[model samples]
Target: MLELHLNFCNLVEIPDAIGNLHFLEILNLMGNNFSTLPSLKELSKLQLLNLKDCRQLKYLPNLPSRTDLSSKRSLPESFSSKKDPWAFERFYDYMEAGLNTFGCPELIELERCTSTALSWTLQILLQVHYQYILPSLWNIPFPSIISSIIGGSEIPSWFNNHREGMGSIITIDESPLMHKGNNCIALACCVVFGPPASRRKAPPIIHSLNHVSVPFLCAEDRITEDHLWWFYVTSGSHIWSTKYENLKLQFHIIRESDIESWSFHGKKYGYRWVYEKDLEESNLTMICSR
Candidate 1:
């Protein structure tokens, strides 16, 4: 078969026979219970593989490389090189056929960098869950979604709707249809970790809109360092969908006193608001980044 759609099927595993379908190109396995995937090294034509909402999935298998390592086809006399059989020129030649306006080199490189960053961030979250005892925070179900991380203690002042309390109401003038163009329908927050309290678990951060409560895992660590823990949720994910205009959104932290400073994680935008505490980590941040 050329296409397979098995989303929301409560699937625990996929058989290896899937790779045998050399002509298969699309595979959809979202909203399932699988934890891993089989190798698709033989599916040369495969593309558009979707695994969204596979919450239990923990890892992926080896993917086929861009070239066939075992192929014995003879090379042209002019192209033969004595150095490395698989040289940069060989790879470039292989890519020449598919290089187009939309799939240009720069766009491809950007996609690659984004993919790498997403993968690294997911790995960090997975390890955090298995190894730490910090208050459990829920993570986005899929790894392919665009996300980011930064360290800070205060909410950026740009969010004119924010307030000092654990929960506040904010309104937007746009409708749900207008938000379709945006990748994320939800927002995330960075909970500031204050002085450690022994044997006390911090409360989960909750976002309520239209009577739906979005519970996020509390961030662990002392605010002494410069780093903000981020968590995101999509609209209508665990809650009923609500329109964006005149939105009644509320932020709730069960133990507001424990949270020294907090801020919303702006999707696709960097923060211009700097808190006074950020200066202390200036040296360490520069050293690590360099």
Candidate 2:
């Protein structure tokens, strides 16, 4: 079979023989009860593997090189990639395939998993990006979306170049690492949105505006009651002059009711704002082409 979905079947174990399906492109085993998965190295064509909400799953096999593996609520410290860190890197490499560990709570010992496990996962993501020199997503040619938004109102402590609590404008100074000459420029912007707190009869509708002089593709998502919005954007522009030598990026989150006061001066913009913690790891990485 080219595609197989056995999600939430209350399955405890899968036979090893399933791996013989060499043509499988998508294998979905989400919401199952299994603790470990059988190796399917033979499935070379496998592209998308969804193990979301597999709370009991404690292990993930080394999927194909291009495989996009996504698992949320996979709270176990199951990524034993001491031999191959690539196994863990693939999880966040595909920006289109979100790794949503938000709202996934579990207990390992006396500590809450949201803090401990999530920390480990983000660390690995940063390490992979640093070691492997993260490749570009197929949709964009330069300045890949190599960032992620964890499910929390507050930004993580490890974040770099960040401002804390309220207000929308953020400035990123030009880094020496960025190549000179703006032949092509891109921003790996990630913003995490949490449920807005409102005490009135109606809850506030949150929105983030991008008021920068850059070419960015904007995508709008339906805002539900308590969903964490994951925003990753890749932008490239040559029209920018050397006037922006410092490159101060503005990221903001505002309420829907306040959109009337905001001016849309024809700049390419998107909704939602980034929680500021200045994750030095999560920088406004600019791809300045030489």
Number of the top candidate by TM-score?
A: 2
TM-score, cand. 1 vs. native: 0.28
TM-score for candidate 2, please give it: 0.39
Model 2: lDDT to the true structure: 0.37
Taken over the whole model, the C-alpha lDDT of each candidate is: 0.36, 0.37
lDDT for model 1, please. 0.36
Measured over all alpha carbons after superposition, the RMSD of each candidate to the real structure, in angstroms, is 21.0, 13.8
Listed in order, each prediction's TM-score against the native is 0.28, 0.39
The stretch of ten residues in a row with the least summed lDDT in candidate 2 is: 213-222
- Candidate 2 residue spans exceeding 4 A from truth: 18-20, 40-44, 66-95, 98-186, 189-232, 235-290
**Candidate 1 ranges with C-alpha deviation above 4 Å:** 67-266, 269-290
